[model samples]
Target: MSSVDICEKHRQQSTKTSFISFAFPYSHLRPCAHRCKQYVVGRSYLLQLQPKNRRNSHFSYSCEACQTEARSTSTENNISTHALSFTERLWKTYTNTATLLTNLFPLWTLLVAVLALRRPTTFTWLSTPYFTFTLSILMLSMGITLSPRDFKRIWKRPGIVILQFCSCYFLVPFLAYVLGRLFKLPSDILAGLVLVGSVNGGQASNLCTYIAKGNVALSVIMTTATTLGAIVMTPLLSKFVLGTVVQVDALGIAWSTIQVVLIPIALGMALNRYFKSFVDIILPISPVVGVIATCLVVGSAVAQCNKLILSAGISLQIPIFLLHLIGGICGYFLPYLLGYNEVVCRTVAIETAMKSSAFGFVLACLHFTAYRVRVPCAISVVWMSLVGSGLAVFWRYKPVQNLKGFRSDLAQRLRQKRQLDEMK
Candidate 1:
């Protein structure tokens, strides 16, 4: 039997013994009187009481106090155990399914798009209002997960957080713009790529940094700061880069950013603060909502792939996608070489590389009719999930080599231990 069953059995036995002891007065009970009489007659009949009878008698017996106690304990145990098991199962399912989907989603989206090319009308449903709603829901879920503690930590370590955000908002976007210009990508795709690069770090960056044993607080702050900055930066950079190719209104893009990004986050923060108990109650199930929203968004993007491929063409997408992958790698590691610690480096790298493609895609749909504008963002979404997850796993299990600085820290810790031992 499972440990739970074993524990339940023991609990029931204990409860039965307690109830039996409480129910009968030992001095006045017939069994006790007879046992005493037998003892006086120099016989041991007490041992001859049937064990089966003792066990069965307790089950048939019920006392008001004992019953109440037993019922309360059982109910509490059942609820706690059930809740724990459900959480464990949900986490297992999310990680496993996310890994699977991340690996296969891009290829699946591309293949389905190619197959459905001849019957374009079949996939037309991807452009419906439901798809946009799913995107909005995904953003809301992401916003709720952003802890305020992240910002507090940034106040403590402003330099590191600022450096990380600079890498994300300034360095990465400029690199992507330069690469896009050099490659001479099509107008819509180039605008999309620049927009993707111009946006802030994704929500997944915090998850990745946490897994990597990095400064997750810094990552969260950087994400929040950069996201706020994106309201102005994304539109301005997009206009500058895509001005010759296509018209983009910077003020309009800023308003869209405020509508989609700022409003939801502010509302979520307020709700979380004012209804802290309610948020705590729902926090366990928040991941479920996030996973469902993510799936819907991906499915919507995939369903729109035919239009994207038709308008942008495979050749343009292939090179730009490759460029994006390379840019992400460069963005991730550059901070490390610039004297930041591994944790800061990992955070910066992830933040710089992983764009908030959901934001980009939503903005694209709002601003442009061309489905091709979402192609780079869609592809990046899948690519970064796969790459970021792998990096997270790697850092989680990666052996810690005692470099000079780490060894010095370890030495200081050992010295403190020795001093404490001496004091003891």
Candidate 2:
């Protein structure tokens, strides 16, 4: 019926006779007419057996067809095994390296920022054009991670999206204004603080969201939406907030946003959709590359403003730190008050707190003349990154819980129902 069945049947017959002799020619490749047993030992078939009574007890047979087939099968198997092992080894190496790089992100950014501040010349080589290119690459990496399915989630939950947008635009900007006024900051510093607040969410917020076990898809959508809106919102908010103090060039900032941020993201999405196989291989490394690009952008900014920073006192640090802290706290509490779950709250909070400070630094250098104008944004990159990373690390080990209002609201409803029953 089958080779295995035939081999099993012959194996039983072989056990009956201690020895049997059967022989066949190598060329004929056909079974001999004489009745004989056939069995398989290992990979090759055993075609003959001799009776114990015979002088020569060992049976022998030759068939070039069976031997050739066995040899060919074994050779192919060896090659396939080697190929599979090599591929698996390569994949493991890639994933291990990528994971290492992703985990070391906080260290990477902090180290680059400290080094850049200490030795400005080391990072000054990242000029304006190279800086913009690097940002585009970072944006492109972010884009490749997204898909059409991710965008559909945005439409599915418009309320969450709108709430995050409001927090990004209104809450952060207003917080910056209040902090600036309370600190009694100079005109340039105030303008820079407001400008940083008005810019879109930074790319690093996605990493923080992932670390915190927040809604990563929501974080990506929020970043994408805010960045697209920044073309108009950043300039308008800056002009409205800072116009009294400085001559704001709204047009220039809009053009820069379009050129640097939007196009790269679009290109990356197109490439991911079209060249999925290639992207899969590159995707693991993209985050690490993005981290390096971000470091370069921050380092360049620090290098540019090294002198102003060394001379400035603690007065400058307080406002920037407060801006991020206030924004983060407000972002969480407002959403929690509105009855959102903890995941959404965490996502919104991170997006609100981590502004595109690099974009702010670039705009400041382009539009503002005062050294103080660039100082807040330059320092913002360091403090916001540290604060966000700390929150992410804390959240990673902890479980997310529902807002306090969830229990309070349930109790209030129970009370109202009891009162209605008593009245009836």
Candidate 3:
């Protein structure tokens, strides 16, 4: 029992309850506030808290909790503050469990990859079409969570978004090409790396941004912009980069990307806009659903290419890891040096580093000239998930106390301009 409840237990049952109610001199007291909730006992008696009880019209009442502590010999305080009630405890447990599961995204992906390698039959049963369907579902889950307001965030800081877009599309792809070639990987493996680099940012980046306490709204905006642009960008980049190595089916890739990624996301946004009530009901579970879909896609890809992955070993693995790690490093430092806030730096880094491996896998499987290309996509999924999530967890503990950055006058001018715009 709470100390207050225990002390008030016996006295409450009896009509004559003695509470400490002091009458202050008029000058000593200000106005009485209801927030104190100091007069329950006094009200019943109509003797301590009432106006007639006042001499110079100044009555000061003690808190019930304070009265309980003063009267009781017990040391425990109220359960509301120091202790949690049944429901409160239950809710806390549930949230903690959810956060734990959510943060372990890398573990789940890695475990499934290991299992797929050891026993391909487990995930191999889920065919290419299933992976494709799941990717569409993942895209749809992201789409449902987006609204016009998400797009509007771009207008608030067009400069940051533009920089982020350039970083994601330009820096990552260039890094992928350099790493793939510098590692002296085979033509198909190089193609795979290039394909993964060309794709849009994954929905997973949004989750990581949220975990890192970065600009989640900006992350979502960047994700949406790139995803919508992927239809054109993915095919063109693939054709240009892989033209000599493989007969790139630019048209096929574009058409399939539209069917797999664009259609579902557009449909989802339309549903969210037109059927908001239904969307609200499912919105809470969408992120979990997206995670499940993402896991399935990654596991399926890894299982399908287990023999190749086993053969490639670290020779292939090093480039894939560098593809993400270097991309993320460049993503963060570019923004930081240019004077973006830490939150923006984190958001841009995650978006740039984390490829839509699921989407890349689908495209590589569907349209690539060589089967080995899909192997990189599969491994990229595993590596990017690990790298992005690891960075997020590392940054999560390091809280952002200052919104303004120290590196550049550009950020200050931007902030001042935004303030002026808001004022106007």
Candidate 4:
């Protein structure tokens, strides 16, 4: 045990005649508040003396660990008086900047979209390969943030997960299809809109949920579930929705989804499970990296679709905007109508609206080469980002409460004001 415990045990075992002695260094005493205080004079035989009982003979004991602890504490106190190293200060600054950018994800998306539109050629360099790498990194970042606790949440609240999947996969895709037909969009635009809806939940939705103070664990689980399901669902749903208009390579898109979404996320989860320490170091800056990667992906897609956007004008942008707007509103209200909490409503809304625009863009580019399928996905990256982030910011500032509660709170405030006026 410890030195104190050892001394106490010795005292418990000793007779009245027995005594214990401890010898401590002079230099360690001044710096260590917990250690002995008495000092010896003029090179005395002992530094300090404490005896439980008087005896002719006594034994001395010293604890190396206690001495080492005292010396280390003194060193730490001394070091606190000095300035931090350049590298340490630099890391602190870097983390602060990264955290700030990470929190303002929507702003980053908007900036990237505007920049991409203004200078398409500048961001055209972020090609297909770079897009995949960026998305893979983003998914990896998401995976590292997950834990067993997140998975255990499934059993705890299976209904929320089920409702989210229904909203994300079924309700959203149906709305997209209906909107495409209602708008009487062209074949290419219709296909693009449907494909966007058929894809997995947005990469940034979980982050937005966290920012909004919603159910982050639920968000993560829903994203992961939807992403994993996308391998089968995305291609099948796209084919079902777009088959009559154009020939869709469902198999090709499925394999792409596997490569783009499933594998990277799985790899990330594994790393988090097996290599947590490495993941811990990477976690601090991973969100910013993901956001930067998202900006590049969205920007590059927008750049590539610049001509299409300018020529199509509102015809293309309107459908994409409507799709996300409808998705976000329906996702929230549907869950709320079902009597779920405000947190679940917010989480589902974000999840439903924020489809994987990058994944859709990649699929459109790879499968529907002749058409401007990527245009809708690119536009969606900007639109849904603005919508989702705006909603999140609103929820962040406004506390979610029912109308009855609000009315009650307002009445209470009015009563308090009346009391204060009477007192005055």
Candidate 5:
């Protein structure tokens, strides 16, 4: 043909070749491009979807699609890593047998004490200074777990603690007395039950409060304050309730309580102040220690079951023990009706039901050689623990309807304020 035509044909061929080469890759890239476009759109949609001011910095759509994907993958990895670490720690702390032992120590101690009672001659050492020393160790551990900061918080909000003490000292005792008379329980069993009801809250109160999503700080303060107060209040209330049946040495009981509860706790708190690190290290182990003590105490009590049965007779005293359960349930709910919140009500309820039965056991051993009086104390420890723990678990997972209402009110108020500011 012509030179110009040939030049034109050559140009067309070059253009066609370039188009074919680009098209081959372009077809392969379509899927990736589409995915990138979709990811960008999805991110934008999510960004626009968030509540005002609630969108996090990482959630912003300023990055390119590839960068956004990388950021999301990083965030997911971080979240999964954190979650796994948390679960591992939780399993190590709670699911382990060591932790269970810590939680059940008190029960075990009581059990051992009771079993030793079966052959009092064989385990005479339990009645010696060693028993007192062991109890003192438990008290000290409890105190170390507490901080002055807890007391300060309680001082700021004293209402709940005061209410808990009132319910335990006044209301519960009155109910127990009235019920004991109505039930016509055996004189010894009634006396023991009344004494148990009159005493302050147990150390387990803190654990239950924590489980129930109640105020741990408040529970701790109440436990500490009431424990100190119990030295006086327990005796006076006991005298008032049990005086008709048996003479109670109010001052003597007060001294016993002080020796058992106050001295150990004070020693622990003092040590914690001086050796803060030691306290911190032992704090986690405190629960384990407590569990062992509990188990020992329970086993000891159980070992004396024959004596308890002989002195109190299961039939006669079973009714009194039942009254304790009923009284506890009543005491727990009454406070709720009197305008107290769930946490305070739970604290009061548990405190009202469970006494330091270990103290009661000591008193029974000192005052009465009869197993009848001690029977009630032995039963109190196991029953209160089982019931209180059940209640705590129930409350912990209970639907948080009240919190939802509070959040709703807060949101409404914020919306109103924003509208007002706009008008201004």
Candidate 6:
């Protein structure tokens, strides 16, 4: 099909009969320009390049025969080379369609929340049991996506993880407390806001990080760290902040956190490690499943608080919106100020801005249901998704430039010291 094959065939025909005639078209001309007399095929030459130093610069010529043979062999390795069975092909199609749907989660969440506000009855049915199940699926999706290498990234960069952990557990919660008080939100709503901040980074953080072209592995690791830490941190912090307002059950909160976040994720990771083949089949649809679960969770919470939302003034919305807005702004700035790379900064920003609202809702339902606290958690979910998605889209186009700062300076100094020590 290629010039190489054509010339090879022509050379073989000539060897069996006579020389290649000049009347033959240029398309079938031999690669070796020097082999015109009797058209005896020249030995395959070494690779030739015009400007060898510049990879982008074109001009490569080769006729090793090995190259052609290697390419043909690689073709067989491609899926297209083999006959796929009907089910195999059908499954591939389903996964592909699911993946396409998954990318529309932001739009889908916004739409479902709006719908739930109108018809509470429709979504309210996805109640307590559904909430737990959906949240588990969301976390499970995150779990299966991960590998041991993802956890290794945590150890590879513990400092960044620490910063993220502190930001998630400390900075955001403090901001929520201050914002709630500053806005003079209702006591129950204040408790809800605090609960929102106190919980771990949402599974959605990983998706947002990926959209922003951030360090996804680092995001996943930070997510895992924050989530595991949340079991202890969330209950204690929520109690500390809301003790005066309500009876905070620290142990119940801790157990619920373990049930919702820890167990499902651990089970997912175990499946990934031990049963990779099964994981692979389901991996494509994992995000889609998470998105569906998230939408259902969002819809249910919004539906439950439908009357509250309809009657509630702008006073209720401002603090929750501001919570994510300010958290996202500061989340990005803190890491950038510390001179972390743009990707890491983006990852931390998303993780800080987006708390596990579904998890928060479940907790509020379990413990603070009497206080009508879950309403704020529902509201927080909608707002944070919008805020984080907006940031991801905005930063996708905006490039980070000349990021010279403390981190870079520190690296430089370390390199210099190492060089001096070597010289000595």
**lDDT of all predictions, in order shown?**
0.63, 0.79, 0.79, 0.77, 0.64, 0.79
lDDT string for model 2 (1-424, tens) is 2333233434454443222223322331224222234433311233333334333433323233455566788899999999999999998998888777876776887898889878999999988778778888888888888777877777988997888888888888888889889999878888888888988998889889999899888898999889888888888887787887778888888888887778887888888999999999898789779878888899998888888877776888888888888888888878788877788888888888898898888788777777678888888998889878777888889888664545566677899999999999
Per-prediction CA RMSD (Å): 10.7, 7.4, 10.0, 8.8, 13.2, 9.8
* Candidate 5 structure quality by residue, lDDT tens digits, 358-408: 666667665554557777777776666766676677888884343333345
Give the best candidate by TM-score.
2
Clash list (residue pairs), candidate 1: 332-349
The predicted structure with the larger TM-score, 3 or 4, is 4
Against the true structure, candidate 6 has what lDDT? 0.79
Candidate 2 — worst ten consecutive residues by lDDT sum? 17-26
lDDT, model 3:
0.79
- Prediction 4 TM-score vs. true: 0.77
Q: Write the per-residue lDDT of candidate 3 for residues 1-424, one digit (tens) a residue.
A: 1223322433364444333223332233322233343222333333445556555443334445555555563445354444557777886786676677666777888888888888888887789887788888888887787777877777888888888777767777888889988988888888888888999988888889988889887888898888888988889888888787787899999998899888998889899999999998787677668767777887799999989999988899998998899889988888888777788888998998898988888888888768999999999988998999989998999988546664655666789999999999
Candidate 1 per-residue C-alpha lDDT over 1-424 given as tens digits, one digit per residue, 9 for 90 to 100: 1222222323344434444334333432332122222211101222233555643332212233444676898899999999999999998897677565444443553444444455655545656466666655655665666667756776887776777667666776677677777887767877777777778777767767776677776777888888878877888877777565677777777888887778878777776778778777666565556555555565555456656656656665555555455655675556545545566666666666667776777777777666577777766666656566666667779754423334465677999999999999
The C-alpha stretches of model 5 lying farther than 4 A from their native spots are 1-125, 128-130, 310-317, 369-371, 403-424
lDDT score of residue 127 within candidate 3 = 91
Candidates in order, TM-scores: namely 0.66, 0.81, 0.75, 0.77, 0.66, 0.76
User: Which is superior by TM-score, 5 or 6?
Assistant: 6
Give residue 185's error in model 6 in angstroms: 1.4
Which pairs in model 6 have colliding backbones?
A: none
Candidate 4 local lDDT, 277-308, one digit each (tens): 99988888787888888888889888999888
User: Highest lDDT, which number?
Assistant: 6
Each model's backbone clash number: 1, 7, 0, 0, 40, 0
* Deviation (Å) of 45 in candidate 1: 18
Better structure of 2 and 4 per TM-score? 2
